[model samples]
Target chain A: MKLSCTIRKQQYQFSSVREVLGKASEEKSGDQMSQLSASSALERMAAKVVLSEMKLEDIYENPVIPYEKDEVTRIIYDDLNLTVYRDIQNWTVGELREYILSHTTGRPELSRISRGLTSEMISAVAKLMSSIDLVLASQKMRHQAYCNTVIGEPGRLAFRCQPNHPIDDPEGILASIKEGLSYGCGDAVIGINPNNDSVESVTRLLRMTHEFMQRWEIPTQNCVLAHITTQVQALRNGAPISLMFQSLAGSQRANEAFGVNKEILDEAMALMLRCGTASGPNVMYFETGQGSEVSLDSHEGVDMQTLESRTYGYCRHWKPFMVNNVSGFIGPETLYDGRQMIRADLEDLFMGKLHGLPMGIAPTYTNHMHADQNDQEIAGMLTALGGANFYMGVPGGDDVMLSYQDTSYHDDASLRELLGFRPLREFEKWLEKMGIMENGRLTERAGDLSIFD
Target chain B: MKQIDLDHLVQRVVEELSKKSQEAIPFPEEKELGVKNPHNREVLEQAMRRTPARIGIGRAGTRMKTTSYLQFRIDQAAAHDAVMKQIEPAWLAELGLPELYTRAKDMQEYLMNLDSGRFLSEESVRWLEQNGDKHKDVQIIISDGLSTSACEACIPDLLPSLLQGLALKNVSVAKPLFIHRGRVWVQDHVASIVRCKVVISLIGERPGLATAESLSAYMIYQPNESTVESDRTVISNIHRGGTPPIEAGAYLADLLADILRVQASGVAYAQLRVK
Candidate 1:
């Protein structure tokens, strides 16, 4: 019997740990005999006692929202002025922050409190405020403006008009951008795709978008640099598919079926470096998702390990131009929710809070089911906690359908849940316990407050 | 990132099914002939022939009719659900809808706040006009309700001119149409009923984050009788980042003559002879 079992084990191996756990669970629970089927009443009593002794507490604990959680949420809510934003007609940041913090009444632990307005949170708020203030101030200021238009007068020309970026007359595109900052437009954003277009067209469009912005005096937003990878099919017309999705499978095909042609990626990088040297803000947004076709097999290739290493390679290569801003760490929907924890663990291994280029998560729109919510929320929470500076999508890219309102509500809800709600009734408690006035200053006992406190 | 050749698989399965049919129909010649080099053109052509051309007329109650945005959303969701519910085993031969509908719904809910600045501007104009006795009706001119930011930033600066523009024309309107739906024709439709000297409709163009929420105005003079696309004038892309809303408004105020002269909308006024 032992010899036979060993031969059987050698013949087949379980695919994963979950499969083993599932088999073990089925074997342990498969006994059909009921407690009443015991030969004697005493045996049944023993069985009942064994079952009663099996504690369910092993799987769950009573939920508690600690004080620190409340405090942190209060701070963010107030700082963002989210409540006043929802109800009132325009509110100051300081005012909203004060209202929420003073009202919060709980003492959740610091860690328990959703890690409190992380650096990412702070930067997000700052960026939003900066944009808002700039817009408001510009409304009052004398500013020039431009629009992008396809024009045909003497010849076909693309005209862009913006505050500083104006391209009324263009002798040469590259030279116009080289003139720099004379035009009123703030900044120009140039985009380049290596795999999609050949070097010439890519260079032309990149140069044009940049030159137009330069003519308009727009400063410069980051240029999104891209590369195309193709895998050869041995059969038929020798067709090739883009490598953007091919990176999802790195291991099995690494030696044989798959190859990463650095020729394109390198050329794109070189052009970006040139652009970055001339201007700055060269960035790369990577695509990490399933390829265009559906397949039955689950294979790991171009895994997180390889991606992180390659990204770092690009970062090192472009250090002179500072071309960094890598976008994807976790691929989208290649795994089920049951498998996300493992995926996130892999992400941590590869994309841990490295400063040169921030990682952005491409969380799929399908993972918003209630069953999947916890996993999705955890993935987002981890990405934020892992020191990712900005998430490319808070909401919006839904199978590319462009359901605008749905994206907005999703952003609002995520903010509330991941961020937390401030206490609306804690103001009196704050005054009584802390003796702070409406302005958050000690009124009666202003002096001799404990430094430690 | 595993790339599976699904199109080939689909063709193979479909061809096998055709072989089993009672009529013994031959698979399209293009599909069968292309063993060495299966070009996409032939495949596409064969697929097109397999499916009959559908002519959808946009009449009310027909599939092509344009429903209100809300109605469109509900109907779309219902259709999606129905398809999922009745899915058959044979249909499993082909891949189905991408499993991201819920995520799309959730994310959509997150980023969009449609009513914030937009509905308010329209509603405010409606309320004031309803209460005021100065005119028999009101013209609630709003820009960029199509995109949230257009209204959020533009309406504050644009409102005064819009009001003044109406007053200068001696066009006292009742509570006017602050319809969220926008296109050149929408302005013509509203102008037909408002009966103002000219109906100035400020609507939002399509938006991107960088250029999104830019405002544009469409004006139609003596509008009625199924006015063509050439019945209005437009000043567009007005935002703090692009064209300051106030300046855009001021420019619109300056264009009253051009509007009256053209008696047209959009590119027609700029392009065609409008003497």
Candidate 2:
């Protein structure tokens, strides 16, 4: 009974650990499973237990819920972001920090809180905070923002590059990789969006990319953007599985497209915890866009931005490495253009950050979306100034396969120069070794094409 | 993501099956000729600001303004040019890309007979027999479909990314070829001649006043004689003004890889059950 209750508490965050534990204490007999199913609050949430119907299942296991897990989901999806953001609009860093901390029980140990403001609020706050007090805010945000790529600690800005190759072309891919590294790309991780949808193709690319990174002596990890099952299969097959990746949206039908559900996600999270490239438990990378829910047509009457926030809520369970908000990638039918994109980018960042996600801003744009690199760069700048946890290090800020322009190596350098942010720690060492970085600064020769030659 | 395409597929199926059947497909709801404003005056202005469409333009003494009239004339002229303009053969020659012509001999003939625009000429077939090599796993065909400007504008940025991405995948690619007057279905012809796994057709989209230089990439996994229309997929609205040319090229690399791996394209690939 205690184990089942604990599982229910973790899976169905609508109820608190206190509620589950409190109810568990009400049972006269320790093994009384009937008493466990009696609560109205739990009846709705009990379905989350995978073996709820299995009368003889081993429901009793680890009943100890971690401190961070306890508070990972609280006051989320309550239509609370705007009210809370409005309440704290004028509060100072210390005051706002204290209020947020007070709300979360797992303080000091866990760096992020799962419940908080929307990206809409964050972007507005970003613009408002851009000119006033960036250093202190960034410091606080950095402290609480996702993983610190330097080691696995929080504070330092994390980043990754996706050298989107056509389809398993080693020469072309290596050229792009060399070019990216020459320009000092690949801070958080170096991943590829494999064009092939087959699981075998993805596994091959993951293995190949991992070996390439290791051979190059680059500290960053690698991932192959493939279907969820393909990634899971690769994990079991002894293929180098970096952070497992997937494009997630709030709608059920959206995930159904990729054959994913909460069960699959939780299962993948479990598998990656065992085998993924690890500094710690966090080893998932999720890409999300605002318009995806509506784009999938399973919006369930929820607005796009709200649905996007719910994706983070679902993601927090895995304690992901980062959530890349693809604000402008969807196009005009959803967001229309640059102005809407800018707003959406801010909202995505704010919400993800609020939900305690290690948030990265891709600030992507496509020609079909009626926007360009310039528009994307502008959005990146705003989000960077807002202290987004990380940014994309794609080649030339262009993804050949995904068909969107994000932050390029030069763009990262410019952001660093303008924003005073540095790459993750290990990548910083590699940069210094290559003489691309000196005294934590990009040299004049930073993007010289001669490096590749 | 493949998921979006699948979800989009399901929704499209429902929409197609449910809509009242007719001999001709209607222009989309958004493509109606006149302005329809039911929102408040202030709200209408806000809506107009968000889109490029000419909306919220109040009547000028019950007649359109000179500025609006001039703008309409400009758009109409650009549309005319988009349809009539021919992609110079010299353009392809300078790029050192291989070139070909469809069976269609002229623009008027091409317009009148869609079938003529979708097949290669006898001489073109002979040329392919000599030059076709399976060294490249993917074949790219650049064509002037409905808007030549789109073809011209996208080539500079799109080609490098596509080639670079393909090279990264180490997927061998044959020398790119062009079509003087081609349609989306021409890819089947290219694939029939070239024994490659995939054929990508970068063709000009139907030009609109909003943007003339927009391109579309029509991809087929294994185009052959028995290929159905459902066996094709596309990434469209590509240009500096739509989906960036370079980005689209890179995206195609990944899509091609997917097509090759799954050995399927279009509706089948999207609906393919992932293991």
* Range of the 10 consecutive residues with the lowest summed lDDT in candidate 2 chain B: B27-36
Please give, for residues A258-352, the per-residue lDDT of candidate 1 as tens digits.
22333544554454433332332332233333221111111221122222222332232222212212222211222223243324222322222
Which residue runs does candidate 2 get wrong by more than 4 Å? Answer: A1-140, A143-155, A448-453, B1-275
- Indicate the worst ten consecutive residues by lDDT in candidate 2 chain A: A54-63
Distance from true location, Cα of B221 in model 2, Å: 15
Residue B262 of model 2 has an lDDT of 88
Q: Which residue runs does candidate 1 get wrong by more than 4 Å?
A: A1-259, A275-285, A289-333, A338-357, A366-382, A393-395, A399-453, B1-275
For each candidate, give its TM-score against the true structure: 0.28, 0.52
Model 2: how large is the Cα RMSD against the reference? Answer: 21.7
Measured with C-alpha atoms, the lDDT of residue A57 in candidate 1 is: 22
Q: Give a tens-digit lDDT track for model 2, residues A1-453.
A: 222434434543324322332232211111121122225445433422322221111111211122233221231333334544454444433333334334342333223322334322222222222222332333334423222244224435556766665334554555456556655667667777775655677787787778877776787778877767668877888888767898887655566643566677889988887777765566788889876755444444434654576677667666788788886665454665677677677766665665666778888755444455557778878878767877877654445545445776657767776776767777888888877778767664454323433
